[model samples]
Target: MEAPVSADKLRFLIYRFKERLWVKPLTFCLLSIAAVFFAKIIDGTPLAEHLPIIEQSSVETLLSIMASSMLVIATFSTGTMVNAYTSASNSSTPRSVSLIIADDVSQNALSTFVGAFIFSVVAITSLKNAFYGDAGVFMLFVLTCTVFAIVILTFIRWVDSIARLGRVGSTIQKVEDAAMKAIDHRLNNPRLGGFVQPNLTALKEQGAEPVYCEQTGYVQLVDMTKAQNWCEHHNACLHILVLPGDFVSPNNPVALIERTATNPTSNKASFESTEAAACEANDIIKVGHERSFEGDPRFGLIVLGEIAARALSPSVNDPGTAISIIGSYVRLFLCWAKKDEIRDKPTDEIVQFTRVSAPELNTKDMFNDAFSPIARDGANIIEVAIRMQKALQVIAKCENKDIQKYAQEQASIAYKKSMNTFQFEEDKGRLDETKWSD
Candidate 1:
């Protein structure tokens, strides 16, 4: 049992915060303000004497120019980003807009522009108010020049990146990357640091108490660490009923808790303990309005599937994009199969949370999420169907039994769909040639 999420809780929170459009820019703005004042510390230092004298007027003029130019650039960049976001939402699935918005280049470029503008304004104000002596002005001058070089380099890089930021190819790649990352994490921590859950019905029959969620939403992050702690505290075993990306309501139970046979508590005390522990167990599960990329590998696959469906829509009718998505699906599943092989081999896969039991992600469900929509939508297009079958053919060759099984299943579905939809015998015959082998 790898306690990845225990450390990841903080990392996950930080990742969520970084996803917001304002966070990086706000950070840069504060740093910019601090930089202006920081240079002031050099004013009375002996090192100030070694610093070449820079005229206050020259520095002031440069700051004024930078301030005005950066403001305009920032405004223009913002509008462009908005347009890119709109383009992404329209061309790709709207779910992918979050990934585009969280793009490092775009965010860094925008943050630099905003931060530079603030830096200029602050520096100019300080200069006008005589806040810097000769030494400070010299140091500020060097800082100003450095800012200029960074802004120019960023602007150039940003222009190149903005050109393709929301384009279909770029957006598809982003989605694929996100999906791969999520899939890799899940493969590494198969049961999310818990033992395989034996049987839910059997456990419940043995007097396990189901812990119901207070609200209705998708399960975003299941802090397995917290669940482990709860189990340790009560000397009980916890069975996680819901995996990340599972929809839950007050009617649905998030987990089940059963007292261990070794526990010394009597029946009366155990019942009371269950009642008191229910709320604590519930808090370990974090629910949200929409599905998140973290903790939910299926969400990424679902998003990719949605994109392929959108491309196959009559309005878009982009079979090429659909084919590309199928290729991405192949890469993701192949990577998954490779990781599955590694996980199966005996290694230091430590079981830290002995009291926690979590369900493994179903390969069938993952295949359904990744391929079903594309199979349905692309049934009529021989190119997409051929490519999809071929992709499945490759995946079905993997040694991992689950991967091979599901890939074959999806291939069968896609083949049947093509048989029904193809108007020409030649098209059907072409797809048949790419069918998965035993």
Candidate 2:
């Protein structure tokens, strides 16, 4: 006959143990069952006879099973506690003392006790069956493995953080000033100007042997007899000095028909007698002259050159300007390629011709032409131009207003010069190889 009070107290304690932290206990039970099943599968083999004596005996086997169960429970509880701490730290909510106390009572203290007890049971069980029967050695091995795994994971995370930090830093750094100067210098070169076909017969008769000059403002005219005859008959020597491929500045000399002593003298009496014939010849010459005058240099070049100049200028560090300039150039090139004169020429031919004639041009394949001077100098120019633009954009962001304004003006001038030169080339029929080359 147990006392009524004692029996009631015992029942209450049992109920409380079953209900308190029910989820964690249930999880432990499930893990234990899984471990038991795995052990049974491994031990039930035909080679069980050769198994260790401690593993064969029921008491030792049970201890080994308990050891595995304890290890799992300890690992699970430690991981859960770590996760909780991390989550709480990262949360945006304000921390309260009461909430912290409650968490410690319900989760930290209780869970740790449960986990540690399970691990102790498993460790003891494993030690009982271990070959050397050295519990300390087995325990040490388990601890070492756990620590090593944790260290490896932590190291990986640290490496990832470092990589992310590097990328962010680079993204925030400002642009350079030397880059802008280089870009402006390339874009504003006078060699990027337009072309003009000269009177070939007049030049030939004047004992002017065509001399190949390096950046001397003279581009050799090939197969331009038709254009030359027309200009000669019109009594106007075509301006070959301002050839479609040459870059021109306001200071560049204009092409003019100089009357040398070699030109035939006009006999007034003979001119009157054959006035209609002379007039007809003059008209033919005028038509030819008009045909030889191709309108506007390469629009693509003008737009791109201006963009490069502006982008590289120390006054403006705007990425929008670079993008805008690039976009405009792309559109203009596409449009120009579709024109009557350019339509028939291969893409390679057009690129080569433009690149060869204009050393400062920076578009892809600008130097494809064997005859283009750009092949020799274009890549260096382009690389420097790009660097300069980046540099200017960087410097502009940090510079004073007065300096910025001055830089802006300089950029504007360079841009205008580039555009003017490009336009001059486009107008002279350089964009269309058939019109100019033939």
TM-score of each: 0.95, 0.21
lDDT of 1 by residue, 1-438 (tens): 123357658757976986899999999999999999999999878898788888899999999999999999999999999999999998887899989998999999999999999999999999999999899999899999999999999999999999999999999899889888888787777778788788889888988899999989998888888788667666688889888899999998889988776645543234356567888788888899989887788888898899889989999888898888888888998888876675675544735568888887888999999999998999999889888888998988889988888888999999998899998989988987887767
Off by over 4 Å in 2: 1-239, 243-295, 298-300, 307-309, 312-315, 339-438
Error of 2 at 401 (Å): 46
lDDT of each: 0.87, 0.33
Task: Compare the candidates by lDDT and give the number of the best one.
Answer: 1
Candidate 2 per-residue lDDT, tens place, 44-146, comes to: 4565455444322444444444455545644654565444444433321112111222232334333433443454355445445652332333333444345
Candidate 1's clash total is: 2
